[model samples]
Target: MKTPNAACPCWSGLAYEKCCQPLHKGGEAPTPEVLMRSRYSAYKLGLVDYIMKTTHPDGPRFQADTAAWKHDIEAFSKHTHFAGLQILSASEDKVMFRATLFANSQDVSYTEISVFRQHNGHWKYFSGAHLDP
Candidate 1:
């Protein structure tokens, strides 16, 4: 059952309505949670523009080539599914958390402590460190 409006279940721990839907629907979310969830949705949906829009300009890893990102995102989506997010700490513009990602299948997992920043009233991803499971 793949409907365009259906919420993705690849973690971020949010149902469609309470999570990425607002961002996808042209609403604003200020918290790291919202931004993170939306970013995960972006990955699932291949929304390169949304990823660019949410990414911090000042962040060290910001890449301007959206086309390249689009390709990378597509490749990632083919092998990845967001499992869930565990927020370790957060402030107005920063979030540190462990996100579990499923790849190949549920039998394989990837986890990371991702960092995010809020820029221009939106949440953007910057960098992250892999966590040991």
Candidate 2:
């Protein structure tokens, strides 16, 4: 759990309030990379509603069972350690990054290129393609 003044969980080098809080508080992320970093911070903070709201409904990863999906996300967030994030690249709609993590003291880090799409007027997480670490 991080306070508003604590370092951002996204490893953005900015405090939580200055970095992800605004986005969590209904501000829109201007780009996919920003949204992805905020999503990582959301995961670290266990902000499940933000995760749910930011996921693209039309994307393949959008789970229809809201209750189950929220539960799964909560479980993961509680059990996993969000160790670090490294942005590899960013285009107009895709952001590639490596998320270093640990679960049950076992390393579970991964690199991923996340895709985003604009739905209505806001950018939403669409999908992710995992890469070998």
Candidate 3:
């Protein structure tokens, strides 16, 4: 199910208007942590443009089919719900995070040490290593 644009329940702790929606609307997210939360919301909302824009170009598995990839992500998110995110630490270009997501009729969690880089004065997600949930 698609989340309402007026308010997101993804638990970023900010109302939709103040949070991910803007990022989805082509606004720059200030931090990797913010970008990460918005990315989760993008999956929930199926905002392909936002995902493609924020994703690091150097990241592996770059696909040319953005719309198809969006559909794939949405299909998965529809079967689940975004729960919450915790930012463990952050530096100039990296962030450690733990995100709680409920999926497949069950709740699953994951930790990621995400690396980001500043390009053209904007932060873009480059890569990440999944940690034990």
Clashing pairs counted in every model: 3, 0, 0
- Cα deviation at 5, candidate 2, in Å, is 1.2
Write down the RMSD of all candidates, one decimal each: 3.1, 0.7, 2.6
TM per prediction: 0.72, 0.98, 0.80
Q: State which candidate, 2 or 3, has the greater TM-score.
A: 2
lDDT of 3 by residue, 59-113 (tens): 7634567778767666766776677777889887888888787877587778998
Segments of candidate 2 deviating more than 4 angstroms: none
Report the Cα lDDT for residue 83, model 1. 65
Clashing pairs in 3: none
User: Predicted candidate 3: what Cα RMSD to the true structure?
Assistant: 2.6
Best-to-worst order by lDDT is 2, 3, 1
> Could you say which candidate leads in lDDT?
2
RMSD to native, candidate 2? 0.7
| Each model's lDDT | 0.66, 0.95, 0.75
Worst 10 residues of 1 by lDDT: 1-10
Q: TM-score: which is higher, 1 or 2? A: 2
| Candidate 2 lDDT, 1-133, residue by residue in tens | 6778999999999999999999999999999999999999999989999999999999987999999999999999999999999999999999999999999999999999999999998999999999975
Candidate 3 TM-score to native: 0.80
